[model samples]
Target: MKRSAQPLVAAAVLAVGVAGVFAILAMRPTPEERPQVKRAPLVEVMSVEPGPYEFVVRAHGTVVPRREGDLVPQVSGSVQWVSPALASGGFFGEGEPLLRIDPADAEVAVESARASVARAQSEAQRARRELSRQRTLAQRSVASQTNLDDALNAERVAAASLREAEARRVQAERDLSRTEIKAPYAGRVRSADIDVGEFVARGTSVAKIYAVDFAEVRLPIPDSDLGFLDLPLGGGPGGGEADGPRVLLRAQFGGEEQMWEGRVVRTEGEIDPRSRMVHVVAEVEDPYGRQLASAGSGSSTPLAAGLFVEADIYGRRVERASELPRIAVRDDATVFVVNEDNVVRERPIEILRTQSDRVIVGGGLRAGERVAVGLSEVVVDGMTVRPLAVDPQSRAPMDANQ
Candidate 1:
């Protein structure tokens, strides 16, 4: 009976303690709930303006002469006198005497031929007089018909001999003229192998020369780049500079940069089978002529042959095109366009041309449209952002921040 009473007393104490704890928790105030706040990303944006855009195609080539070949002599003889203009790097005018061979032999030959012609004329006159005398005698019954016939034949033979001698005289005169070698055109001498008293054979090359009136550069451009240029299908419209496109050629000269203006004169009829490139011939008029004096341009330097050059060919103009920074465009021709509220979305644009640092957008864009030039790489579409307007040229943030 004593053990059962103790157990009942312990259970009553434990129930009282539990009731006291619940009453204390019920008296505490309820905690207040709070909300979380998120900020949008900051992005650099630029306003795109659409207008006419001119495209340029670049290529490289080496300068070359329009006409170049070996200078060969027509007649063979020892070079008695060599002109100063016949040496290497020398300039000469059209028909200028380059050298003179020993004309003593040629002059003697001419004189001898002339003397022979004079003797033949004397013999021919004598034959004619004898033939007339024979005819008179035959009519008077003094000379027989056989003698008349003989005189007539002799006269004919003498006339033929006179003609032969005249031909020899003409030939000798022509040979005498050939002894003095003259330049065929106004040109510069590339090299010379003959000098005073040097024996050269007929049709032998003695020097090299090239015309200096103009220079031609064979510029090979990829077949795909043809669309940018306005070229005729068959070939460039003739060899003159009257038509086709203009090319600005640049090169290093006199330890400085230089520029020359040229025109597309023609293109090769057949494409290069190996490279699949079309070779267009550009002509620069008066390459050795005077140039405008300017600083840092080496303007006085002539566009000499064999100099490697870079060309910038002016192409057609595209209307309603926008120019954008290269980074703003992706390889798949898409860009991020920001809206008025700074929300971003991807937009596809037609890329007319691509350069090292810029891209020409031909269509699918309008004026006053904002393009996000700088943004997070992993930013997704329809994401909101803090827009910062920036200058396109300097790339510095402008005063406006949307």
Candidate 2:
């Protein structure tokens, strides 16, 4: 009994010691300290500077010739000669002979007509002489009135015959001239259907050609973008060709990038039924001219037909417009602008235009104010933020690491 009582007293003492230690630890005073406030989140920002900005409308289209036609023959005969430049991809000038038909038949017909005309002229002269003689005889009372009438009738018939011969001679000359097939304009041959010694009929297509004087591209502009462009749509009041907006076309040619300058000539009269888009025609003059080929650096190439290209239409220049990164504008047309105290305040902004990389603000921003760009955290109105200011000129981030 005594040993059991001693073990219980020892266990009770250990328990009391452990409880006392915990109680002392809980009662002990710690060093006095103050609570800390959370630091503001760091955000990169850019200054809002409203200034002159040139609006550019981007579009794409296929290049095509301004004038395309099929070369047809006006006169038919066996081909006597074919110009070397009458093949596919050959270039020729206006009125240049592309082919010559055998002039044997036409030449013979012309000679026959000429001889008949000569014979008719001689007969008409003889008849006139006879008529004069008959009139003199009548005045001298040597010829009867019936004889005078017969002489007049013979003179009239001879004059009609002479006119008929002259008409036939002129027609023969015209047919002879048409034996030489000529190019109607300065252009490049797209194809050829005939060769030397090959017979062709009149009004048959010989080749396909397109004028190289100018080219056109039909660009589809969205209805929303129409406000940004001053196109001559439906001949509406958008200004004349002399003061039309300029367009720059870019494309890959000969394994290199090439650029061509053009102008907005006109727009489609109505919206396309399928796309509901307005197509504007841009004209590039002298597409094949050496001056145009050398417009850019490096060896330049011509803007050939059927080439796909991108176009940049120069639009109106907006003055004092605020330009901001796309991320700065929210869905509700509001931006997080950093106030003077470095606190983010949500402010409404008028979006004049939206581009691929930036947004043009028409109002609600000052020249020197800072707007938060690319904030990683969820933004709240009137949230205090540490703005890492960005230089307007260099576009470098300031206090970025904070």
Candidate 3:
């Protein structure tokens, strides 16, 4: 009886356990049948603000002088005096004496010329008096015709001699003036060779110098960049003065970076055959003038010669255009514009120009429209997106929490 009772209890426990498991399964909630929901991608967007935008083209070049030449002496002589400002890297004023050759020979030549002129004048006067007296005598039948002819010839010869002496005198004066070499313009000396007591020949290059009134920079830009610049195609003033497009030059100077203002002065006469680059000349007036000092909170710096600088040239102004990040535009010249409902669709845009970092759009988009940025090629039309507003300059999300 005990063995039968044990089997019966075991069977009862197994049945109870199975019933409990079934009861718990019945109490569980049933799986609900529903349609799948597509997940929308998160995208960064920028608001298009179409307005007048002056394009900026970047280029780099070395600063140079608008006018540079070798300082040569027109008259040969021993250098009796040398200007301190005639040395290499020296500054000088316009018409300032750079060197003084020994003027002893020049002075002697002038004296000799003056003496010749005086003698010629005396002879000419005496011959004129003699010719007049001979004319009177011939009219009175007192002098022979041969004698009157001789007097006339003497007067003419004296007059010619006087003219010759006067020419010599003028030449002597010119040679004297050239003995002292003066600066053609206010400039800095690039190099010098002669010194005091050194004999220099005529037309010898004693030094090399350049004008500092206007510093020039030859900026080489691609031929494609020509359309954006209002350069002087005729090599005239179209690229200069206040009317020309402005330029901002940046460079490291005095152990710190500095900025300078200039303008496009002109373009080179011909394109570079090998590079197809068109070099544009930029001019800055009074680079070393007083305007550089205390001009703008100790920030106005002079554009020195030979300084390697980066140029940001202001180009053509577009009446209505928007600058978008380069990644925003697709290869097909289309952009993804996100609507108010967060639906993105491909829209064609008229691209004016493409730069390394951005694209200048001329048309095909309205102001205040959100343009998707940094989207992948896998983007499809009518795709849903979670839009995030971003800064125009930095492209960072405007919301701090983002």
Candidate 4:
């Protein structure tokens, strides 16, 4: 009976162990039943059409006076009055009085000189009458030849004295005119150094005037660019109308954009020793007179002397060069062009020029070809790309903050 009971217990234990193993096996996962992760979508991109574009070179430069002149007092005198327009940045016309020095002393000198001239004229007339009388007396033998000679010498001396007095008078008048300062050109007075009651010595600066009728822009180009310049016919860099090269200049001052059309008038004739750059001068008409006028009190925008500016000199434009967005060209001078099958091919390109947002490709690109713009790291040569149709207005990428 004990043997039979042991067999039944063993069979029951074996049956329970087998059932537990089956249950564990049923809950275990198979290779085909594992979880899979979904991938994020590729970044959307736009395409650019290649075409002929203009080439431009950008450089920085300074705005300077077309012609600047210093107003200096020719005669010394105390300042008696100044023009209401004599302040710094004041505008005036040609021959306009800028300031007035005390001319009282100059006037007194003029009067004194006139009186001397009158006295000299009386003496000269008397000498001439005596010489005539001596000549008549000598002819009649009433006067000796020596007496006639003495009378003639006296007349000549008197005539010399009269001429000297007249010259002194003219000089005195000129000095008086100098006391009244006048504008040398039609321009704005940059500065007035003298004031009412201020004593200015001779040759002292009374004011500074600049002509805005035409303004000058001095551009320093590398000596290599000399070939492109149309040098003046007879005069080297700075002379002759032939030296002037037609150029377009756009200027901005105080948030207002101004367009100036001008020509390269001349060159500085020599390259700078340190910079190896040749100074090219271009002339533009100050039509509105804004650049030559002072702020608020003038008709045009005030272009102050010595203001720095950005200049764009239009070089030769290649008619057949391929132009694309700057982003389409990589740093290695390679561009990724999309084939008809929508496959990207890396093509080597020769960059002719680069403008602000565009680049001109002189080689390795054909017209009407689509180029990838703003590509991601995943995009490479021969990689498949699905370009989304980009809206012209809404193509800009959304910022992360948005």
Candidate 5:
């Protein structure tokens, strides 16, 4: 009975061990239970457009009066009165009186000259009567020829004295008239340096005036641009022109667009020593009283003297050049162009001109080629890209990868 019990216990222990081994095998991991990795998303991008480009140059310049003059008193006198409008930044018309100098002294000189002329005239009349008497005595044989000749000479001397006095009087009158300082041309007064009761000397500057009929804009072009500029090689209107190149100038100021029709007036004859640029002058009409006034009136728009301005000189327009958005151009003058296979090709370009928002390409681009606009990424040659099609109606992105 004990032997039978022992066999029964051994069988029960073997069954328990087999159950434990099966549980351990179920909890262990296999090769197929490991975690799997996720792939990154593709970078969505836009397309590029290609076309003709142009070359352009930019420069800075200043505005100046077409005609400027200094107001100087020709005659010396004490200042009697100054014009109510005579001050810095004043405007006046042509021939307007800017200041009045005391003319009393000049007038007195004139009067004294007139008295001298009168005295000389009286002496000449007495001499003529004496000459007549001498001639009669010589005819009657009562006087010698020498005595008559002496009398005639005295009369001639008196006549000469009277003419001299008359000439002095005329000069005195001219000096008196000059005591009033008048404007030389129609313009605005830049400054009035004299006032009432101030003593002014001859040839002293009393004021400064600038003509407003027209204004001048000076542009500095590099020596390289000299070939494209149609400058007057010879002198003509401003000097003279012997059939030189002609350039068109378009000027914009204060939100208003103005077209000034003029040719290159002249060059500075030499390059600037400091900037190595040649100064070119262009004449612009100030018809709206923007630059100057007819009389001493201030400018309505006040294009004051020495104002800086931007000038655009229209060079030869390229008929076949393509226009592109400025952003399409890279720093190395290369652009991303989409080929027929939708692969981006980085094509090198030559920039002709860069306007406000567009660039004109001169080389390495043809008309009607698709180019990228406003792209901000590192684009390489033959890179696969999805071009976002642009909607013609709304100018917005229509679809991705079109």
Candidate 6:
């Protein structure tokens, strides 16, 4: 009787546990359904305006002199005197004497040549007088034909001697003049390696100098960029037309940023073998302060030699082209534009020119179109976007934050 009652009690306990589990499950509430929502991407956009645009090509190179020459001595002599401006880094005017070699020897040489010339001239005069006498004597039959011939020969010899003497005298005078070293042009001395009493030989370098009126820089341009610049590749100044396109050079000097104005003067004869790039020469006038006084402009910083600089060559203008920010242009020559329905679509563009900060498109874009300049995420065609317009004057974008 006790065993039978134990089995019935276990069965009753299992039924009560199952009923409690069902009651807890029924008391819990179900989650409510929510509607699907899509949010549009926010982007900064600029209006596309087709008009005439001046393309500028960028390049870099080192500053060099338009004209540089070695100061070579023409006469061999000991340095007798040195000008104060003959030192390194000294400034000089054109035709100013920089130094003087010992003129004592040169003066002596010139005097000796002059004496020889005088002697030759006197001999020539004596010969002429003798020839005249011979002619008269021959006419009277007192002098033979042989005597006339001898007189003619003597006169010819004397004249030759005079001519040789005159040539020597001229050379001697030139040497004497060469004893003084004069500046060939207005420039600053790059280097000086001589002093008073120092012996120098002819054809030896005395100094090095460069013109201060203008400076030159050889800018390397890629072959693809040649079409944009109207460079004088063959040579000359546009057949007497206006000067080449204007250029602006930038470089750091004296711990501050500086800019120098220049123009495209010419291009190198051949392409660079290694880079396959065409080298263009740009010239900056009044690199120093010398020309400022004449132009009625204040003195400004000069573009010194060997300063590495960046150049911008302003090229031909094109009409009916769309110019947009560089960020708006995709790597595949495509741009994201906001259509009338505020949807971003990828459109193919005919790229006319590309620059560091901007891109010019020749086709597939028109005026009154809005181009998305910057996007926060990957974009697809027909994707809805919230565009923030940019002001042309301030170049700032107007958005919710603004």
The C-alpha lDDT values of all candidates are: 0.86, 0.87, 0.88, 0.73, 0.71, 0.87
Least accurate stretch of 10 residues (summed lDDT) in model 2? 290-299
Q: Candidate 6 residues 68-147, lDDT tens each? A: 88999999999999888877778788899998999899999999999999999999999999999999999999999999
Query: Which scores higher on TM-score, 5 or 6?
Result: 6
Q: Each candidate's TM vs. the true structure?
A: 0.77, 0.82, 0.85, 0.68, 0.64, 0.85
lDDT winner between 1 and 6, please give it. 6
Clashing pairs in 4: 231-243, 232-242, 232-243, 237-267, 290-300, 290-301, 291-303
Clashes (backbone N, CA, C under 3 Å), per candidate, total 0, 0, 0, 7, 35, 0
Total backbone clashes of candidate 1, pairs 3 or more residues apart or in separate chains: 0
- At residue 167, candidate 1 shows an lDDT of 99
For model 4, give the 10-residue run with minimal summed lDDT: 393-402
Model 5 gets an lDDT of 0.71
Mind giving the per-residue lDDT tens digits that candidate 5 earns over 1-402? Answer: 998899889999999999999999998988577688543222232332343323434555666888887888888989998987678777676788888889999999999999999999999999999999999999999989998998999999999999999999999998999988787776777777888899999988877778876676778988777654555544333445323234344446577754444445666678888887887776655634644444567754444457565655554555456666677788888888776677888889878766567776777876556677644455567776656655332337756654
lDDT of 2 by residue, 1-402 (tens): 998799899999999999999999999999899898888887779887789987889999999999999988787899999999988889888899998999999999999999999999999999999999999999999999999999999999999999999999999999999999888888898999898889999999988999988899999998889888877766633566656679999998878889999998888788878887998889898787744445764434678889999999998888779888787789999999888887889899999999877889999999888888867677688888877877644557765635
TM-score of 1: 0.77
Clashing residue pairs, backbone N/CA/C < 3 A, model 1: none
- Order candidates by TM-score, high to low: 3, 6, 2, 1, 4, 5
List, residue by residue over 227-256, the lDDT tens digit for candidate 3. Answer: 998777778565336666688999999999
Report clash pairs, candidate 3. Answer: none
**Displacement of the residue 186 alpha carbon in candidate 6, Å:** 1.1
Winning model by lDDT: 3
Q: Write the per-residue lDDT of candidate 4 for residues 55-83, one digit (tens) a residue.
A: 44445566677778788888888889898
Model 3 residue 77 CA deviation in Å: 2.5
